[model samples]
Target: MTVKDIATLLDAKIICCEDSLGRELHAACGADMMSDVLAFVKDQSVLLTGLCNPQVIRTAEMMDMVCIVFVRGKLPDENMIELAIERNIPLLSTKHRMFTACGLLYSNGLHGGATN
Candidate 1:
């Protein structure tokens, strides 16, 4: 699915990188802990998380993620947004909680990435 599709499915608002909505995303993973996200996510282009911090953007950058969905209506601060913008990663905010957001994407055919 595309980033635009995800925003529509989750009822999310695009915080930045609106021009990149056409980018295709193959998988998604939701997490609050940066460590788990760093360890488990592989080839997952979309990250769904409630954690709002600069590290979240950094983690996405490290994982080569293309987009981030902030769950539970959470919003990232200016610093986080700056980093995401610098990294060219689209940021989206959703009112749905983590589980609900993940389920919405998964049920819509966006799967979790491969696991070891």
Candidate 2:
């Protein structure tokens, strides 16, 4: 589904990339550990995390992620948002818990980036 659709469904705030709201998101990655995100995520444009840090943005940039969703109402600080803006990654925040958030997206057609 599209970024806008997902944002609407999750009741997330789109902190950036209004233009990219139409971008199609094929998959999602959920992790709070930045290192694990770096190690595991691939070709996954959407990241579901509770960590609100600059390193999160950096990891997304390195992984070519298009958007980041802060789960459980976590919020990114200005520096993290700046990094995301610089990297052109849209940032989103949702009130849903991590597991429920991921599950909602998965049930709605989003898949894990893992290959069979």
Candidate 3:
């Protein structure tokens, strides 16, 4: 599915980089810890997290992720949004918790790719 489809599936609000909504994403992973994200995530284009910080954007950028979804209604500050915008990573916020959000995307055909 595409970033736009993930946003719709999670009923998320696009916080930045709306133009990237059309970007296609094959996999997703939800995590609050950046360490786990760095260590275990692989080939994932979308990240769903409850952590609202600039590091989220940085991690997404480093991982070459196409989109980041803030779950549990958590919203990023302007600084984080700016970082995501600079990196051209679409940022979205949704009311669903991390698990629920992940489930929604998975149920809609977005899977978590192989990870070590």
Q: What is the C-alpha lDDT of each candidate?
A: 0.94, 0.87, 0.91
**By TM-score, highest first, what's the ranking?**
3, 1, 2
> On residues 43-83, what C-alpha lDDT tens digit does candidate 2 reach at each position?
88888899988999999889887788999998888888888
TM-score of 3: 0.98
By summed lDDT, the worst window of 10 consecutive residues in model 2 runs over: 107-116
Query: Alpha-carbon error at 44 in model 2, in Å?
Result: 1.3
Model 3, 8-104: lDDT tens digits are 8999998888889999999999999999999999989999999988888999999999999999999999999888888899999999999899988
Tell me the RMSD of model 1 versus the true structure: 0.7
**Whole-model lDDT, candidate 3?**
0.91
lDDT score for candidate 2 against the true structure: 0.87
* Residue pairs with backbone overlap in model 1: none
Best by lDDT: 1
Q: Write the per-residue lDDT of candidate 1 for residues 3-99, one digit (tens) a residue.
A: 9999999999999999889999998888899999888778999999999999999999999998999999999989988888899999999999999
User: Where does model 2 exceed 4 Å of error?
Assistant: none
* Candidate 1 residue-wise lDDT at 11: 98
